[model samples]
Target: MKPAVTPAPPAKDARRPPYAGYAMAAIGAALFASKGIIIKLAYAEGIDAETTLALRMILSLPFYLVIGIHALVHTRARGEALPDGRLVLRTIGVGLIGYWTSSYLDFKGLEYISAHFERLILFTYPLFVVLFGAAFFRQPVRSKALLAFAVSYAGLALLFVQNMAASGSATGTGALYVLSAAVTFALYQLLAKPLIMRIGPQLFTCVAMGAAGVAVIFHFLATHPFEAIFVSPTLWGICLALAFGATVLPSFFLSAALKQISAQANATIGMLSPVVTILLAMAVLGDTVSGSEWLGAALVILGIGWFTLSERKG
Candidate 1:
């Protein structure tokens, strides 16, 4: 070594992080959209909703528990106070309602609907977020937001026309279940947002996911047999995919993406999710969309995209 030359400092990043952020968001959304498709596939294997959900939670539990432990160790090293009892209880409650309850309804809904329909219905959550924010958080609802809701829902209603035409399908009931899931999920976001601000999202999510995992376990014990978990190999694959690929990994990716970009941009770019779901549903599940249904999907995407970005600007 010539005169103990100091190693050159690491090069600074010149490329803005938004490129990676957008890619992560898009990939995360696609992975998330795959949840419905995977759920449908598992249903075809004749797994009940309770057992199916429990399997997913059980498989995903390790990821959350590990994160939770990491949080604890990190906090201790930093001499930070641990979350108080109130915060812990609040997180548990949010986890129950948001993940357990919402996922229960969603899986039940998937029993009766195509993945395509399920995705379209779930995409309506932004509208519920607006309403919930206005009603509970006292956030002022602007005209543009309302207009966005109207346009999106009008598109959804047009899809309902497709259901109406194809009578005898369980579309009505499925739509209700999925819509309930979206509302509860929105509520979870609203309630957890403040707590997330107080305690970091990593810690909050770890706690919340652990709570939801416990709930699913209890539900499984109450409603399913012990032997039920040792089912067909394909079902196990689906559960693993949902737990890791769709749930845990993409969740982290979405969180990391948020760190790089604003939530507005994340949501705006996430409009691609339904498109991903649509393509998967069509290709993998052989589901078809009519012209009117395609129009409805477009309207939903455009409306929510507009609403999120516009609200951010305002």
Candidate 2:
């Protein structure tokens, strides 16, 4: 009998992406940028950050609860055990820091600075991830990662300097708040890496978000009256967008993306986040964009895209 012929190996260029995860990251990044727009719009109606945050968490809370319960049931039916006590508590802690604290800071900063300014600062979270991950987790800092970091930050620095020259340092308070938000979010990314590996993205995100939701609930109750819910119709509509579009969808997308990609890689892809916020702010809020801002944004885009491509090849 003749020997059976073997099939040829696939071409190198034919390597396929884990599309679901990549889509999640890209879509989630856009949705996150959208939140800044929505929050700014709501703030126009005179709502404080806490009230806006409470509305978002409360509206999005049920979705997280259902997702967590569903995950538990599915795992149980598959004869897989749930997360242990330690993991659960750790998730809660990370969630409070990442979601509750970071988001609160973000909204507060938005009150003082423009949406574009807030987003640019918040986008620095990836750099913070590089620092904290290396320091705490001993994650190797690759040369390519460093190059990408330098390129992206150079862009941000250009924008910051130009904005300062034109507008002065009046936004110092807002910048500080947004910077704190970025750091906490970076901490969240560092904390999430191992946890996502163990418990799966869905369960981990659900648990963390739920913990954050509860914290926000307590905060809102402590400060605001029950009638605070009865905001103007426009603000109410903005709240819905914030809840579903920004919070729920992006949370799922980020969680799923983290499952397939390293947190640093995922965060690097998010370099486009500020661009999205800038465009939205220009259209919705009439924020003026300087020539320097345009050039800076281009640099950021190049750096992030180059890094993402390099990672895919490796």
Candidate 3:
């Protein structure tokens, strides 16, 4: 009688390559960079930040609702315990800070600053992420990370100086608003990791987004007239594009990437965002780019590419 053959089990290292995480982060950052352009377009249509954000959340809510329900059902089918109330609440809180508060600040900042400058300011969130992670999470600060930051922010400083020279003190308020958004977003990235690990990225993203959507809707109703929701079809189309292209897809991509990479790495990789936003601003908005801006952008890209290669090797 022939002996029964045993099949080989999968290899321990069969998981995705680290580059896959980098790729996901890069794509997410690029997509997210489109947001500034879209918001600026909406602003040109005479849509205020409050109404724009409200419409974005309203349009995005249904997708999160459907996805959240599916994630719960899948968890049950897998015989997994559902997230406890505490976890759910914590996720929602982080979501509100990240999406609701951060987004509001960003939209308001866009009103005062150019899209390129707004993106550049917002791109500084990684510094906060690294600092907060080290302080609160006890994450080790690698020397390479500092070097990458120095290089990247050197470029950012150049752009900041040039923009300040050009725009003067008028950019101060918007800069502050975007900086606040960066801080909150940094907190979100730091806080979300453990929750994502426990509840899974798909469920966590859905819950967080759903909660933020609700919060934004409530805030809108409280501050704006009910009739403000009725906007021109062009604005609605812009909101739709913002919801799916920039918000929904990139949110999922980022959440999934977080499952694979550390928040520091993910945030650092987001340096690509400013470059994308700069190009889009020039192309779509017909904004002018200075020589210093080009040089600053080159440095940003160089630093990011260096960091990405280092991460891949690690």
**Cα-based TM-score, every candidate:** 0.92, 0.84, 0.83
Clashing residue pairs in candidate 2 (N, C-alpha, C atoms within 3 angstroms): none
List model 1 lDDT by residue over 63-165, tens digit each: 8889989988998999999999999999999989988999999999988777877888888787788899999889888899899989988988988878767
Poorly placed runs, candidate 1 (over 4 Å): 1-17, 167-169
Candidate 1 has an lDDT of 0.87
Which residue runs does candidate 3 get wrong by more than 4 Å? 1-29, 251-272
lDDT pick, better of 1 and 2:
1
Q: What is the Cα-based lDDT of residue 280 in candidate 1?
A: 96
lDDT, model 2, position 78:
93
lDDT of 2 by residue, 115-199 (tens): 8877777765766787798898897777887888889778877877776676666577777889899999999988987888999
Specify the highest-lDDT model's number.
1
Query: In model 1, what lDDT does residue 232 have?
Result: 87
**RMSD for each of the candidates:** 5.0, 3.8, 4.6
After superposition, which runs of candidate 2 have C-alpha atoms over 4 Å from their true positions?
6-28, 143-147, 165-169, 251-271, 306-314
